[model samples]
Target: MDKESNRDEGQAGPVLTRRGFLGVAAAATAATAGFAAGARAATPGKDAKGDGGVLEVAIIGAGLAGLTAARDLQRSGCDSFIVLEARNRVGGRTLNHDLGKGYFTEAGGQWIGPGQTAIADLARELGVGTFPNLWQGKMSMVSGGACARIESKGGFDTDPRLTHELEEMAKLVPSGAPWKSPRAAEFDAMSLGEWLAKKNIPPEEQIGWATGIALSGGTAPARLSLLHWLSMINSADNIYERLEAVKEGAQETRISGGSQILSIKMAQALGDKVRLNWPVLRIENWQDGPVAIHTPNGVIRARNVIVALSPPLCNQITFDPPLPPRRREMQRRWPSFAPARKTAHVYKKAFWRDKGLNGWIFQPKGPVLWAYDNSPEDASFGVINAFVNVSALPSDPKAAEVELSRIYAQALGDEALHPVAYYDHDWGKADRWTLTCISPMPPGFLTTYGEALHPPAGRLIWSGTETADIWAGYMDGAVRSGHKAALNALHAMNERRA
Candidate 1:
C-alpha cells in the first residue's frame, strides 16, 4: 500500500486535538467558517476553445473554492472546466437547517463581516444583500452555577500585559506562512495552554483568555498551537477585536439567504457543469495532462484538478502514486478536534431587544459554550444561535433541548422560556464530507507540516479555506484560495499551450 493510503488506515475516527479524549466546544463561536459557491444560472460557455475538445480544469469538492474557480474560468470566457462535488448539494461547509417562512438556522457557515472582502464583493455581485448581526444589548455570563447579565462592552478583560505580549509575538508570525518565521519552531513547540501557563496568567484572568482561545481555535486552548493562534492575530491586522468582534469584526454580517446562498447562486449560474453525488474515490495520472477522477457514478478527466477540501477530507480519497511524503504526513497529522453542533432557539419575537439585551450568552462551563442573536433582519422573530459544548450539555436529544432553553432563558428572560421553534445541526455526526467543524491546529503542527498545507502535487492543487493566505479558516480565505487556484490552473494551462 502507498504510504499515503496506509497512513490513516485503522485510525479511530479523525485526529483529536490531544489524546483520545473529546474536548469541550470552543468558547468563541462564529457564524461564518467557509466559502466556495455554485449556481446553475450562468449561461453556457462562450469560449469554445476552453472546452472544445480538451478540458482546462477539473475541480473536486464544489465548496467556495471550486465554485469560485469555475466561476472565474467561465467569466474569463473559458467553459472548458467542470466542478465535481461529492455531496448531492454544493456549499461544502455551508448549509442551513429548515425553519420555514424564509427563516433558517444555519447548519453550516453563515456569517461574514469586515476585513473579509472577498466574500462581501462576491455577495454583491450575486445580488445578495447582507444584514447586521443582532448583537446589541447586555451579554449574559454563566459560571459556577450563577448567571449574571453584564452590559455589552468592547474588548475582553484579559490581562493587558498578556495581550501586549501576544501582539508582539504575532508580529513574528506571517499570516500566510507562520512556519517560515524565524522563531517558528520555538512558537510552534508549545500549545496555547502551555504558553499561557508559562506566562503565569492569574487564574481570574485565565477564564476570559481561555474563552477567546477556544472560540478562535475552535478547540481548547491547551490543544491549539501557540504559533497558529498568533498567526490568526496577524491575519486580523494585529487587532484582536477585528478577529472576534460581532460588530465591526469578523462575525459582522450575515447573507440575506444564509451563507450557502452564495454557493447556490453560483451553482445556478454554472448550470449542469457541477456534478453532485460524485464523491471522488480515487485520482490517477495526475502527473500529466488528462487526469482521471474516479467516482461511484463515473470517472472525470481534466487537464488540471483543484482539490478544494480540507486536509482531513482529502485523506479520505486515495491518490494514485500517492501525494508527496510531506503532504501525506500533513494530512495524516492534521487534527480535526473541533467537531461541534450549532443550535438555534426560535421565539415569537426578539423580546431581548426590547429589554436592552444583546441576545449574547456565554458560559464558563457548558454544553452551550457561547451564544448570540441570529434572528432575521426584520426582527419579526427571534433566533438565538449557539455552539453546543457537549462537555456540559446532555447527550439525550430531549434533555439537551430543555437544558439549552433553560440557559437561553437565563440570558434573555422569561421570553426565552419556550421557543416557538428549535433547530440544530451537528457537523461531526453529519457526514464524511464535513467531518470537522473547524481545524484547531495543535502545538508544532504549523512549524512541522504547515508548509505542505498549500503546495500542489503534480497537476493537483489544494484550494480550501485552510489554504488561504489571510483569514485561513474563514469564508474569506476560502474565496481567496479559490480565486488564486483558478488563476494558477489557467496560467499553467496557458504555459502548456504556449
Candidate 2:
C-alpha cells in the first residue's frame, strides 16, 4: 500500500497524506498540465465579446470576503466575473482538512459569534446551523508554576486579590462603548500592558487578561493597541443581549457538515464564474474603462474588483497607478502579526469531556498555550488544538508532545489524557500576502488612521473582518464587507445604467 493508504490505515501525527500533500504542493504542475491538455485557453485576453457589454468583475483572494462578493454579484444579476484564489482550496482562511477517521478540523478562523449577520445570513441561506462553544466544565489554571482546577460553580480566581484587582481594572474602563469618549484617542494609544501597570494590577491579573484575550481571539494583549480593545467594546456596545444568550448555555456552532461544505456549495452555485488555480499577480485600473487583472494565466478584465484576503496578502498585489497615497500609508500602518498560528490536537475520543474538563487549559509557558475540544457532534472523535507561542517548535516531535502533555497535565489536572494526535499551521510565517489573521492597530489606530482605514479611495473597496462596522475581526465582519461591497458595486452599476 502507498504511504497515503498506510496513514489512513494506522499512521498518524503531523504527516499529511501523500496524495493530499502532493496535490497541494504540485498545484502549479497540475495547472500547467491541465492547460497543456487543451482544457481551456491558457490566456484570458480582453475582447469585446458577449452581447450587451459584459460587466466583467475580477475578485482577488477567495476567502470569506471574496466568496461573498461573487455570491452577491450573482444575486445582483451579474453574468461575468472571476474569483482568483491563490490557495489550493476556496475557503481561504476557513479551510477544513480531513485528519483521518472521517473527521476534519479548521485550519484557520474557527469561531462564529452570534448575531454576526453576514456569516449568519450565509449559513441561513445554505442551511448551516451554529452552536455556542462548550467551555462550561471544570476549567484548569496554571500560574507561577502552580496549577489547580476550579470546580463547577467555581470561578478562575487562582489568586483572589489579583482577580479582584483585574476586576477593578475592568470596572475603571467604561464598559460597552468607549469610542465616543474624549479620551478615546488617548486610550487607544495605550497598550493593555501599560494600562494594567498604570492601574496597579498584580502580575497574575495582568497575565490573566493578557493570555486570556490572546488565546480567546488568537492575539497577544500587549501587541493589541488600546484602541483595538476599545473598538471591540464599541462594536459590542449594544451587545448586552449577548450576555443573555450566553446565560442560556449555548454551544459554538460549526456547519452541520463543516465550513468547507459552505465553500463547496458557494462555488458550485457560481459554476464557471468562479475560476480555480487563478493566482492574481497585479491589478491595473483605468479611470474610464474596465480594470485589468494580470494572473499567471494571463490578463483578466473586470468592471470592479473585490479584495477579500487578509491585510498582509492584499499588500502583495501592486495596484497600477498605485493605491491612493493615504490608502497605501494605511496599509503600511496595519498590523500583520495579529493573525498568529493557532493549532489543535485531534483524539480518537474526547476523554476529557467526560472527566468534567472543558478542554480549556491556560499554560503561560508551554507550546500548547491553550487547547479546546473542536470535535464534531458524533462524540466519536475529538481534536485538541494548541497555539504555540514560540516561532518554531522543538525539532523533536516527541519533545513537543511532552511539552504539551506536561502543560495539559498541570492545567487540566495531572490525569488529563494524552492526545492521540496533533495539528497546527504556522499562520504567523504565512507570506507577505497571507498571514494567520488580521492584525489590529496597536494603541494609535484611532489617533492615526482610524476613520481613514474605512473610506473608499477610487476603485478600491476595503472589506475584511477588521473593516466591518460590526464584528470587525470575526467571520461576520468578512460577510458584512462582502455584502456591503456588493451593494456598493450594484449601486454604482445602476447609476451607470441611468
Segments of candidate 1 deviating more than 4 angstroms = 1-54
Best by TM-score: 1
How would you encode candidate 1's per-residue C-alpha lDDT over 1-498 as one tens digit per residue? 011111111111101110000111122012111122122232223421244445678888888888998899889887788787777567777765444545555656666767789989998898778877766668888766677877765434577677778888999899999999899999999898898888887776776787766766788888888899899989888777777666677777777766766786787788678776678899998887577777776566778999999998888898888888999999988888687777767778888888888887888777766687777777777778787786677655556668888887777787687877665566666677787757888887888888898888899989998999999888788899999999999898889889
Candidate 1: worst-modelled 10 consecutive residues by lDDT: 12-21
Off by over 4 Å in 2: 1-54, 143-146, 152-182, 216-218, 238-251, 395-399, 409-418, 430-432
Model 1 global lDDT (CA atoms, 0 to 1):
0.73
Q: Candidate 2, after superposition: displacement of residue 394 in Å?
A: 2.5
TM per candidate comes to: 0.88, 0.80
| Candidate 2 residue 198 C-alpha distance from true site, Å | 2.8
